[model samples]
Target: MTATIVVPTLGRPSLGRLLEALGPGLAKHRFELLIVDDRPGDRPPLALPPGIEATVLDGPARGPAAARNTGWRAARHEWIAFLDDDVLPDPDWADRLADDLAEAGEHVGGVQGVLRVPLPADRRPTDWERVTAGLADGAWITADMAYRRAALARCGGFDERLPRAFREDAELAFRVRREGWSLRRGRRRVTHPVRPEGRWVSVRTQRGNADDALLRHLYGPRWRQRLEIPPGRRHRHVAITAALVTAGAAALVAASGRRGWTAVAAGAGLAWAAGTAEFAAARIAPGPRDPSEVATMVATSAVIPPVATVHWLRGWLRRRAAEPLGSQPAGLPPAHRCPAGWAALSRPTASRSVPTRPFASRSAEGSR
Candidate 1:
């Protein structure tokens, strides 16, 4: 089977390492390579190996979803395999990928590659490292996923409106299954290493709450249930944010000499403190808990709730009247309808089952 490898990049230094890691696959496989650059303006040329050819296209810089759409749409083969620029594919990736494609039944529209994240052996991982490691148990993440060209075209590719890598892949998977195509877990494996980032990375990640809100708009409030995604901390964030807002409001009222406002302010302030402390402890508990890590956790824990709640509200208000991308499929249910050829795909064999551990769905911006 012929394939095209599509990688969306932001011109990070990891791009070079990723290309080098693909050498073994390129040497043995006949698939084409397409690199979609999501950066703007003049960029340095990529160093290529001898006897290898690749196509580099300019991306819209919208996000990984848009960039991936650009890559697969321009692909020359029936199968388009997506890989993050930071992941290292196993040396036998090409062979395993080919086997996987060959094994895909006629009704199978997509295949997900297994992801393995390497964490520190001697010490507990930091919060960012733990977040990055979530890809290992994530289902249908574009970190290492492939789709048949026909399936992608039928689903209209990814929802570019997502504006980020978050949830877009899983959303597409649902749409594909809703269209009567089955998705399978492939044997190919990729290693996702944790990339270093600033101390405030957790605060930055709270922005995904906005994407979650948009998803809720598109798929309805039960989107998480329909998509089989576990619940997030959105509820807690909302409550914490409410406490903070109440504290500030009541404090202002007390400063204005309102008699009962002082009690309200004190109560709200204590609630906020308690919520923040719990959040910080939860994060710091499983971590290495060094002085710096603890301090970062405490600071970001205090800041994340309000930021997340703001993003969530902004997303909801922005897409308040937006319609779903399309009509829902009519049958047993939208996402659970198994067509003729999907019985086996739905209940994967023991060897094929995706990992059962809880995982965070994320992107390069925050380790998705």
Candidate 2:
């Protein structure tokens, strides 16, 4: 079976590095490369090496899920391998993938590869980078996943409603398992460099809570709690709000000539300071040079919980009515349209067993 490597990019020329890293493997396997550019009016530099056929597919700037679907649809191969823009694949990655697919047999619908990261030594990592680093070295099915074209077609690709990169891949894998297909892990590994991110990365990632709500709507409530996915610091939000309210009441009482106001303010200040300091200390390294960064981290800590809580609450409320989950997009080609009168896809039951864990790492060509 022919293989196609689909890379979804946001017009970052840095993505060329990912393609370059895969050159040896792609050339050896004679695999085609498809680059889907989601940016409008911007084209990625097309200076690809010989034997790698690159095509740029344009689609609405919905998100990575949409971009991946667009690229996979444009591919001509029976199997589609997905790589993130920030990953560097090993030289033998392609051959290992082919062998893994062959070993999986016909019922195997997908294969996930291992991801490794080498962190920088000089700089203390920001909280966001720390979270990202934790994701590396784990069995992740989303970043380096491969799927059969027919299986993807059967389940209607990724749910485009997932507006961000987080958890969308897991959601797709969950659906694939529900369909009674197996997803095995490959022995090949990819290196994911820790890119520099702004300090607000953790704060902004609170959007993931909203996405989690969407996943719950699609997969039911047990998935999150069972998977031990922490519901984004909602308890911290309640604590912050309580402290603020108590401080406000204390101020009003003091203005009315009451002695209790001092106690209230002291209590609130102590609670807020302790909470912030604890969060900052947990994330920051202790050193003379890190004091300023530590202070900034502490100051920002209080704001994160409330923002995360509000976003989660909003998502939960918006989806409380149990609206139809996956409706076919309008104006799709006749072949891409969902079957008429087909009942809406329901949440797959947790009792359903996944034939093979999608994220397990195995040997390539029977070699470690």
Candidate 3:
């Protein structure tokens, strides 16, 4: 089965690195390449590897979900294999991609490639690295996954409304599964290197709290359970943040000089400080014990919860306003579209089983 390679890029220099490793083998495997540039109007050109036939297209700066929609919709082959630009494919990736779909039954609609993140073995990993490692265990993440063009078309491609990298894949997976097809896991290993990034990146990812709300809107409150995600501590974070804010406000009021307020402020300050220390210590305990690390953790832990809560609230409001009066609750197919008719509206239960095969077994004969 011939497949097309689609990578959505922001003109990252690492895109060149991925191609340097993946390009040479493309010719032998007869795979096609499409890179959707997500930069806004008038970006510079992408200089790809020589001797490779690649199509580079510009997208409406929406985000990875929209960019991917543009790429796969333009694919020439039936199978659209998506790899994030940050990931480096194995030398055998191209051939294995072909093998992934070579024998996919008609009932199977997608194949996920195994992702390996090589963390620092000699030292304790940073928080970001620990989080990145979790991608390998996700059910249908697009980090290194391929979907049949037909399956995508059936779902009207990805919901461009998602407009972000987070949960968009799961959103699509939900709809595709509802269409009565299976999504599988394949053993085509690709390394996702943890790029050096600012410490605040972990904090910045709190924006996904907003994305989680979007998932809840689309898939209902039980979305996390459907996806098998362990319950998050976001609610606890929210509570702690509320206490800290209340304590700070009390301290401010006490500065106006009431003795009773002074005692309350002192108690509140101690509670806030204790909570912050606990949060910071949990983060610090996982990694280096240096002062710089400790200070950074202390500062970020204080803000992450508030930031996450604000975003979640924003998403919640947005979803509530956008949804119509009488639609199916969240992730199920709409009444008109579902084969079960109005019955599907009762949150059609998910059948999560899918086949898994290691593409490594089939591609060994054809790979470098």
Candidate 4:
């Protein structure tokens, strides 16, 4: 199978590591490499081994989703293998990818490569490390997934509006499976190293709350259940934020000698503190008990709920204003219904009907 390897880079230092690991594969295979520079400006100068054919293109910098879309659209081969700049491919990646694609049938539209995150075994992982390790269990992440070019065309690639790497992959996969195509897990495995990040990385990730609104706008509120992800405590976070805010306001009113407000404040304050303490304990228990670590956790725990709540609310309100419920985004294909036998997905009524033009046909037209 002729394949093009597409990688999206944000000018990461790890890009060099990934390229060095793929040197052998590049030497042995006639694969084309499409390196999309998501950073704004002129084309980037990426060095590679002799005799390798590679092209670099500028990405919209909307996000990784958009970058991958640019990379795959510019690809020439029938199969597109997407690798993130930070991932390390196995030495036999070429052979394994060939083997994975060789076995795909007409019904198989994509093959997801295995992702292995190597965590330090000596000590209990930090909250950030544990969160990063979740990628190992994450399905269909482009970190090492390969797609049939036709499948990508059918799915209209990915939703470029999802301006983050989070949930965008799942959103695309959710759409693809609706087209009556199956995505199989492939044998190829890549190592996704956990690079050091700031203590507040977890807090910053709440930004995906806005992206979640897009997913709900496209799929509906039951989207998580559709994807089989466990129900998150976002509502509880909102409740916690509300309780804390209400408590503070009531405490101020009570200071004005309002006895009724004093009672309300006391109850709200207890609930808020309880919620915060529970959150802090969960994070603190698994983390290294250093002073900075403890302080960071304490500070972030108080802040995350309100911040996450605000982002979620902003995303929800933004969607409600921009599009009504049950309406699909303009220029985008409607979500495809899962084929019968997917008992779990059978309930999303919106996805039950196929779009007017076949997803592949519409996608091809869109590309032109």
Candidate 5:
């Protein structure tokens, strides 16, 4: 069974490094590589190896979901393997993937590979990068995931509505499982090195909260809880910020002869400080860098929760408005049982006879 490796790139120069790492594996597996350029202006920097077919597709700057859909659709192979432009595959990745697919019968719908990111030794990560880095080794079912072409066609690929590169994979995985297909972990793995990120990485990543809200809309409130995933702290932060703002405004009003407003403002400040301290302490590591970074993290953390909450709430509201009022929810119920005779039946057993009652009962009744 031939496999096509589909890579969606955003014009990162580091993609050349990813390609170089795949050199040995690609040659051994002889899988076709399809690179979808999400950035229209830039082309892939590296040359394709001999006998390895490569294609580039151009279109408007839609996100990775669209690019992946386009690339997977273009592929002629039965299996389509997706790799992030930033990831470096292990040497036996291809062979292991082939073996994995072989072991996974037709019922298996998708395969996810492990992702590892190595951090730098000298510098402490910014609050935002740390949050993003939390995802590095996180059962990342996105990068290095493979799916059957038929499964993609059935589920209609990733939702184009997911504008960013976040939660799109979860949405797809959820849908595939909902359709009675299974997603298994693959033996193959990839190392995702942490690229140098800007100071605003955390701030920029807040947009993910909005996408997450979309996921909640698509799935339900219980999605995170049931999946054993924690809700992003953004909502809690937002709530605290709202309280602080309200109190501060009330205090200013009270200072102008309104005693109630002043009390409210004072309460608000105390609450904010307490909340900040708690959040900082939880995230703080045990080192000299801990206190400073924790402070920065706390200061920035307050901002994120509210911004994320508002954006998520906006997406949720918009989705609710657009959806038809009484549309049926997606997927089958969790506890659906097979029909009676459909299940394999056990051999019929002989009935055990009950012991006879004593005759003394009738004689006693007659005497009464």
Candidate 6:
């Protein structure tokens, strides 16, 4: 069985490593490789290895969701397998992938490969390590997932409105299953190494709260239960933000000599402090708790609540009029015409080639 491997990339340095590791696995299978470059501006041309042949396509720089849609729709095979730019596929990945597809029943629409993240052995993991490790348990992460070409064509690829990598895969999985397709786990494995991050990595992740808000808007509050997602600390974040806001407002009122405002401000401040402390303790307890790690945890614990709350509200407001998954027509965005060079580029070549042709229309109704 042949499959198409689609990888969406921001042109990270790890792209070369992934390609190098992935090449050997494909030796035993008939697979096409498509790399969707999501970078907005011009850069150096991608350095292709000598033996591996890959087609390079331009992404709209919207996000991975848009890039992935650009990919599977352009594929020539029955199954489209997605791998992140950073993941290292096992040497037998393609063999296992073929077996996985061969065993899939007609009703099965998708297969998920196992993702193993490597952590530090000697020291306790940092907060970021723990967060990256969570991908191992994540549902339909697209870190290493394969979907039937027919299933993608039927369910509309992915919601481009989700501007981040977070939740888009699960959201699409929901739509796929809602369309009467079952998803199962596969034996193929990929190693996801924890990449280095800035000190504010945890803070940056709170932006996903906006997507969470979008999910809530699309699926209602019970979306988490339906998606089999565990209840998160969003409720606590909301309470903490409320307490902090109330404390500041009450303090200002107390300065104006309002009766009992000082007590109210004191009470609100105490609530915020207690909530922040508990959150920090929970995070710090499992981590290495080095001075820098503890400081990051404490500082971010204080900042995360208000940031998460604000993003959640922003998403809630932004998608207030959005329809749920199946309420509208869904499928890969339609194309007007293929670029002139597509036919020639689609053919396999002995030498390296990059196809710089636009495939799909940017304007599609209800794709969000």
Q: Quick one: best lDDT, which candidate?
A: 6
- After TM-score superposition, what is the CA distance of residue 136 in candidate 3 from its true location, in Å? 2.1
Task: Write down the TM-score for model 6.
Answer: 0.89
Winner by TM-score: 6
Decide which is better by lDDT, 1 or 5: 1
The C-alpha stretches of model 5 lying farther than 4 A from their native spots are 40-52, 120-133, 136-140, 226-228, 286-292, 322-368
Question: For model 1, how does the per-residue alpha-carbon lDDT over 1-368 read when each residue is reduced to its tens digit?
Answer: 88999988887767767777777777678788888777756655443333345777777778998888888877777789999998988888889999999999878889999999999999999999999998899889999999887676655678877887688888888888877788999999999989889999888877788888888988887999877677888889889999999999999999999899999999999999999999999999999999999999999999999999999999888878876565333343333333423332332122121122111221223211
Give the alpha carbon lDDT tens digit for every residue of 34-61 in model 3. Answer: 8776777764556454555676766767
Model 2: residues >4 Å from true position, as ranges?
41-51, 121-126, 137-139, 225-232, 245-269, 285-289, 321-368
What is the RMSD, in Å, between candidate 1 and the native fold over all Cα?
Answer: 9.1
Each candidate: RMSD: 9.1, 9.9, 9.0, 8.9, 21.1, 7.7
Residue-pair clash count for candidate 6: 1
Query: Candidates' TM-scores?
Result: 0.87, 0.77, 0.83, 0.84, 0.79, 0.89
C-alpha lDDT score of every prediction, in listed order? 0.80, 0.66, 0.73, 0.75, 0.65, 0.83
The C-alpha local distance difference test score for the whole of candidate 4 amounts to 0.75
Instruction: List the lowest-lDDT window of 10 residues for candidate 4.
Output: 359-368
Alpha-carbon runs more than 4 Å astray in model 3: 255-260, 324-368
Better of 2 and 3 by TM-score: 3
Q: What is the lDDT of candidate 2?
A: 0.66
Quantify how close model 2 is to the true structure by its C-alpha RMSD in Å. 9.9
Task: Write out the backbone clash pairs for model 6.
Answer: 156-331
Cα error, residue 73 of model 4, in Å, equals 0.9
* Steric clash count of candidate 5: 3
Candidate 6: lDDT of 291? 99
lDDT of 5 by residue, 225-320 (tens): 543355667656776777777777887798789656777787888887777666666655532366656666666656655666677777777666
Cand. 1 TM to true fold = 0.87
